[model samples]
Target: MGGSGLLGLEVTRQARRAGQRVATTFHTRRPDGDAHHLDIRDRAAVIALVRAVEPAVVVNAAYLQADWATTADGGTHVALAAAATGARLVHVSSDAVFSGAAGRYDETAVPDPITPYGAAKAAAETAVKAITPAAVIARTSLIIGRGDSQHERQVHALAGGAPGALFTDDLRCPVDVGDLAAALLELASSPHAGVHHVAGAGAVSRHELGVLIARRDGLDESALPRALRAGSGLPGPADVRLDNTKTQALLTTRLRGAREFLASPLPVE
Candidate 1:
C-alpha cells in the first residue's frame, strides 16, 4: 500500500489480517505497521520500494498527490513497476471521474470529470488501464470513517452548535472505509481485473446524510436546517450514485449501506 489516508490505512490493516506482508508509506501520522517515507512521484523510489518488497501484488491506495503530474505520472510509474515485477496491481480510484450530468454510474460509465481532483484521478485511471487491463481499478465515493475527515468534522461541528449549510443537491453513495478496503482486497484476489465501482449500497443526498448523522448522534435536525433540504440554487451533482452490481457479485465482501455503515459502531484504526 502507499500513503496512509483513511482508505489506504484500512487496506493496509485488512492486508495484514489476510496474512499478506504489508508495506506502506506515509507523509505524516504513520499507522501501526511497517511504514516508510515515500513520495510516489519519485519513480526511482517507487520502483525501488516495489523491487525491495518483491510483493506478489501492489495496491496503490494513494491518489490525489500534491501535484497533478505526480498522480498522473506516478500512476504510470506504479503500473510500470508492477508490470516490471510481474505483480498484480490493485489501484483505488474515485467516482468523481464521472461528470455530474449523468445519473447513476456503473462499471461501464464513461469517465467525464469536472474538477481538478477528479481529472487527476481520471488521468491516473487511464494510465493504469493503459499499462495493464488485468489491473484491478476500484472506484469509490465519499468514504466515511475516522471522525477526522472533513465530512465527519462538518457533522460534528453542526451537532456541536456550529451552524452551517450543506448542499442538498449533491447526492452520492458514501461507503465505509473498512468496507471499501475489504472489497478492494477481495478484488485483488479475484479473477475480475477491470474497473469496478465499490461504494455504499444505497444513494443518499448530502442533506439526507446530514439528517441521518444528526439523528444518529441525537442532534436537533432544526440546527442544520439548510443542510437537510434542497432549496435556493446550489450548484452540485444531483446524483452520483454508483451501481455496485459488479462489485457485489465478484468481491468476497459486500458493501454496506451508508446508514448501516454509520449506525454500526466500528473502531477507527
Candidate 2:
C-alpha cells in the first residue's frame, strides 16, 4: 500500500507500537523505513507480495496521485490477493465516495461520487466488496495532523498571509491521522465487515477548519483569507460530512475533531 503517505506511515508506526510485526509496501518514493516495492496496479506483484508476507491482516493504505490504475484498480488487486490468502484486509478509503450535494453520509448510504477521485474510490470499494465480503473498507475524511501536507499548506497560508479566499465552503469531517490509524488497526482485528465511516465526530466547513488550524498554531486568524465554496462557484459537490457513530460504537477509539485536536498541546519533540 501507500506506506509513504501520511496514513500509511502513521499506520506503520502505530501498528508497531501496538506490538504487531508490520510489513509495508511503497511505490516510487523510497520510504523512511523498510518496505517492499509494490505497484498495486500489477496484480501479479500484489499477489506475490501477499503470499510471501502471509500476513494475518492486510492493510491497503496505498493510493495513487490522481491515477486510476493504482487509485481505482489497486484496492481490487489487494482485496483479491488478501482474499486468496484468507487474511483480514483493511482498505483505506475516502469520504469522496459521497458527492457533497449531501452530507452526514452513513455506511449504508449509496455512493454518489462527484469527483474523479471519488468515482475511482467508489469503484475500488465495489470491486473489493465483490472480491472479499469480509474485508473492512474504511472510508475516512480529510486526514489532518502534524507533517500532513494539507495541514502544512494551511499553516503556510496563514503565516504568509496568502491573499484570496483562505476560504473553503465545502464541509468535511476532518479526522486526526493518529486517531484514524488507531481505528484502522482496531478494525483489522474486529469482526466488522463492509464500508465504515471512520471520521471525526465534529463536522465543520473548510473555512472553519482553516480558522481552527490558524488559531491552534497561534497564527493571525484575522489574516486568514475567507472565501465561500458556493460563493466561488466551485464545480463540485459540497458538505460531505460523515456519520462516524457506527465506527465509534464498533471500536473504543475516539477520533477527535480539528478544533479539539488542535486545542491540545503540541507534542514536545
- Pick by TM-score: which candidate is best? 2
Q: lDDT for each of the candidates?
A: 0.79, 0.83
> Could you give candidate 2's per-residue lDDT for residues 132-211 as a string of tens digits?
99999999988987745575576557667665565566788988899999999999988999989899988887778777
Over the stretch 49-125, how does candidate 1's per-residue lDDT look in tens digits?
88888888788877663478666777888898898788999988888788777778999998988777778889989
Clashing pairs in 2: 1-62, 2-62, 166-225, 167-227
Global CA lDDT computed for model 2: 0.83
Error of 2 at 39 (Å): 1.3
Every model's TM-score: 0.90, 0.95
Candidate 1 runs further than 4 Å off: 225-236, 266-269
Candidate 1 residue 134 C-alpha distance from true site, Å: 0.8
What local lDDT score does residue 16 receive in model 1, on the 0 to 100 scale?
A: 88
